[model samples]
Target: MNSGKSLKEFQEKLTTSRRIVALVGAGLSVSSGLPTFRGSQGLWKNFNMIDLATPDAFYIDPGLVWQFYSWRRYNALQARPNKGHVALAKLSELDGIEYITISQNVDGLQRRAGHNKDNLYEIHGSIFELRCTSFMCNFVAKDNFKHPLTPALQGTEQEYDVKSRKRSLHEEDASISPQFKPIKELSEEELPQCPVCKDGSLLRPGVVWFGEPLPLGPIDQVDNFIEDEDVDLVLVIGTSGTVYPANSYVDRIRAKGGSVAVFNTDIDQEILDGKVSKTWGFKGDAAVLLPLTLKPLIGEL
Candidate 1:
């Protein structure tokens, strides 16, 4: 079958599928002006984003970690949900069919797009949320969209020009080299403190870092959805399906005989040719393709 036929078949199946899930990733937010936490765009002042997203990094320099997250929060706040997010949000609201979105993105675009919270599971946690660092204190604040979360974080939300590979400081010169970029070492008191902690333990971004277990609540929810019934289809959007647990779901659903439809910028020609069994790959920006592909069910793209 050709790509056109595969898409038509996928759309036909989508209309009648009783159970559906969408696995979303960073690519979905790329069009919304959010950079993926990889590649040159992911670099922050001579630091790979992966290096800054670990517990050890936080342990060594909480202020630095907070600054990185504060920058992300600021960017996420500035970004609006794109068409892909809107389409998925609309799909979540459709009656009759059971649908869920398992998102690996921390940018919260899905929620900002008005996706149903009950059906959406943010596996990576949200940048807008904050939690107490102290294990003794179980304090978690949701929907804390306040940028420069604290006074210390003020003016720390510097934007990186990916094309030029330069840092654009709020009040400083935009042409500053990354090596000479002045590092602001904020004291613990300057960082955001947990209100619930008696001794004022520092609060961390609610995101799950490398080597940390995913939040049990969302994981359990996704697990239940997959185990409960036969999922008719899984719309794999934007993600390369690289990470564990989240990536594992695609295969798990496939094991239960679910069809897979991928919307991405880069896809194998064989998959697009419909040579892959029960799989269809549409190569393009998901923001553009998703709306068109889901238009049949949504009515009026």
Candidate 2:
């Protein structure tokens, strides 16, 4: 209802909950100066995400796909973890609390923010990880964070500003474009390759593609954690709450008698008004709200 009362309840939940899970999304990283995939300035002009982010896209033109991902990796590499990430990390450090962050984002900021490896799950996989596309080859490891692959271009790194794209979205030429297109049509050898595979299958981004099944191990671990522990609270952060499996956790936790709290830019008043029974909603910038709400629990205020 009132701001004072809502904050008091949030602090109470933070202080008393033993098993708290944070369902994180792209909005959590917005303050880190990264652009989300769904908005107006998202994709490079004339390059549909559907045409560039799938296995079919990679198979048809690996060079194009790698170029797009290279640009993404370069941007993600440039962004440092923001206050929201720091706040979530602090939640895990509470003396007796067990906090798990199941992030739908692949940007790797949560891990970069110093969240514990044991408590964090990047359900969509990370951009820094490269895996062989061959169904048979089992080569997958952390990439060296390489940018502007030598074979793809023969000059200093090209400059591409996301701000420019945002500006373009408002201008007469509303199509967002980046300067990181492949310099020339690259052949098979020019793309990233699996060193272990004899047939030279290319390595693809380790993200979960449009139709790909989520990695089994992490999903199983999340399910096991919820089933084994008596979870009391779930903090839904920045997600649109649309994707399957990860999105289903909210209802799953509620079925198990856990309460839900949401932090987002646009929170529905109905959810906060007891329509969902034990749910609370906090609306605003997560980078600003999270630290203010969570830091006091650690006596850091």
Candidate 3:
């Protein structure tokens, strides 16, 4: 955590940077009323997110998977972009600055924040988007926000203390409540299907699942941006920095003589320990930090 003169110096560096990139994660959306995918509150009833997010899970039980996604879509649609999202969007509007936001979040709040589609890369894909399960079908479309595709499958809403337990949103196993009721299974005919496929393949969530590769087109664009430009600064916002490729950007940018600054509620200790060169960690909510940090530079405070 750089402060006083060091902090001022970093701000000046940011104001003068020719190229800037923002690598955002789920934490950025927390203030927008969404839960982090890795937290205890992220659980849908007693369902483990990892179990529900995998291709195998979808293949085994498409109805249960769609039920989970449908709930996520409903929650996401209820959320609005937070100030951090708006501040980053404002950063992109700065004259003479080449900026791009590579987002790990699929909520699409960054796009809703007025970030240009051309300048934004949704690396994990978007919840508002859907694609055919049959990769060969190649059918994809923006979802019509039709949540609860099957009303019969919706779960009863209940509240639990998130602080009571910190469940793994990844692969770690956690106990499911004994009282949990399984999702009402819908037949294949009741599930959403690919509009273009004659064989009636079901549509799946547009997110990058546990073992799935990221969409190549966006990843290539991000790789090209880093390879071709001398990035002056990289802003890491609200991410755990655990996932690969997205997390790998920090090392790649640092290797190119770029500086990194992170605005996070939970700061990565490695950055504070000087594990990366020319790195600074600002510890706080990004909604507060981003506005205060970039406002003087971009007038969005």
Which candidate ranks first by lDDT, i.e. highest? 1
lDDT scores of the candidates, listed in order: 0.88, 0.79, 0.82
TM-score of each: 0.92, 0.87, 0.86
- Model 3: how far is 66 from its true place, Å? 0.3
Error of 2 at 295 (Å): 1.9
Ranking by TM-score: 1, 2, 3
What are the per-residue Cα lDDT tens digits for candidate 3 across 61-180? 888788788778878888999889999888877778889999999898988889878889999898888889896888888645676555554542213333355667855446554345
Residue-wise C-alpha lDDT for candidate 2, range 1-301, written one tens digit per residue? 2277777877887788889899999899888988878877656645776567788887887776777777777778889998899888877666787778899998888888888788888998998888998989989976457776545643323344344333444565664454553334668798888989999988888998888899999999999888897789988898878678866898889899998888889778787664667788878888888887776675552
Mark the regions of model 3 whose C-alpha exceeds 4 Å error after superposition: 150-182, 268-277
| Sequence-dependent TM-score of model 1 | 0.92
Q: Please report the candidate that would top TM-score against the real structure.
A: 1
Please tell me which model should have the higher lDDT, number 2 or number 3. Answer: 3
Residue 168 CA error for candidate 2 (Å)? 20
Alpha-carbon lDDT of model 2:
0.79
Worst 10 residues of 2 by lDDT: 153-162
